[model samples]
Target: MLIWERPEPSARASLSPLSRDRIVRAAIKLADADGLQAVSLRKVAAVLDAGPMRLYRYVDTKEELLDLMVDAVYGEIPAPPPEGDDWRAEVRSLVRGIRGAALRHEWFADLLGGRPHLGPAALGHLDATLTALRSAPGIGDDPDALMRALQAVNGYVLGAVRHEIVELRAERASGLTEHQWQAAAGPYLARAFAAGRYPALAHVVGNGSHQDPAEMFDAGLDVLLTGIAAGA
Candidate 1:
């Protein structure tokens, strides 16, 4: 008498309710977890338990997928602050919102720098931000100054978020808090200062009162908004 045993399953598995939206979402998750370098149609297909070619029905190429993914992220930013008044305040709120969203998705700021294409969601965010700026009491009907203000706000927020993201990543890599980062670097800073080659740097480093990024962001916002109002 012989006993029968179960055999292992085959390699081919049917794709689950796979749709274009789902695939794009999976691609975003992959990028978020493994960095954008790991994101490709084939990789996303693997995660979806589908064949790589299946994604072609939705996205023509990885570039298309990236555009879609960015739009999806932009959609997450809160809607522009309420209309009708306090437009400068509204603009500031929107600025903070964008920065917060970018921080949540670290790839965002990097994406903003490389490409110029605007997905629907990106356009919406832009329109909303511009609307806030235009409506600001001080922005005053002058198109050029309004444009400058928008550009300044966008640049400031992007820079702030990128800086914060880098600091967070470095902290994680070093396993140190911001205070700890300062503490660990303090001694080296002191030793370098003792040499006296860089008086300006030494004075600034010795001050030990430089604001952290969060504080810097607030101060920068105040100065930028104040200047925008003055320019208007």
Candidate 2:
């Protein structure tokens, strides 16, 4: 429902034709380019060559626009098929799609964490996810159990996205590959291990740390799903 426009700076502000969708797209583009701090109705209106007050026809407050933006971004997420042969596979697919969206739009992962859940797109995401979990064997019978499962999965996805974003930012800033980070950390870790200043940390690092996030996610998912199956 959002419309995109590439405006020329020479266009007169008073002559601009603005719609709610256009305003939202401008805000989203601003956030994508300059981070959330750069987004404002006034700023978005200026980008659209319109006045700030014009945006109020659609969005009453900056908060409302942000809510719409979050929904719009979330709407980009692919909702998993209502029926899949395997529930776990379906859930995994849903998480992966969400993760992909977060990766594509770094601001999305950040926005979801910091914003309140108010939009239908946000609720649609939750509804679809819970619906998938409920479709799983055993979860269909208990609403409370289904709620717990959804919460656990949602938390894991949020944490994973945040971790991924931080790693991406670090990689961009340091220009260090995963291998390079490990290689550089190895020497300092070895010295710490030799000194025995932190035996547990030394033992973990010296034994060859398993910091591969995919492995971590798989292990955590396995535990959560296993626990859900057992308890539910």
By summed lDDT, the worst window of 10 consecutive residues in model 1 runs over: 1-10
Q: What is the overall TM-score of model 2 with all chains considered together?
A: 0.80
Q: Rate the local accuracy (lDDT) of all candidates.
A: 0.76, 0.75
The best candidate by TM-score is 1
Question: Which segments of model 2 are wrong by more than 4 Å?
Answer: 1-15, 82-85, 113-116, 195-219
Q: Candidate 1's residue-wise lDDT over 100-184, tens digit each?
A: 7777777766777544447777778888778878876566678887778888887888778888888888988889998988898
Query: What are the clash counts of all predictions, listed in order?
Result: 0, 0
Clashes of 2: 0
Candidate 2: residue pairs that collide: none
Write model 2 residue lDDT over 106-170, tens digit each, in one string. Answer: 88887765434756677777777777788766789688888889888888888988898898889
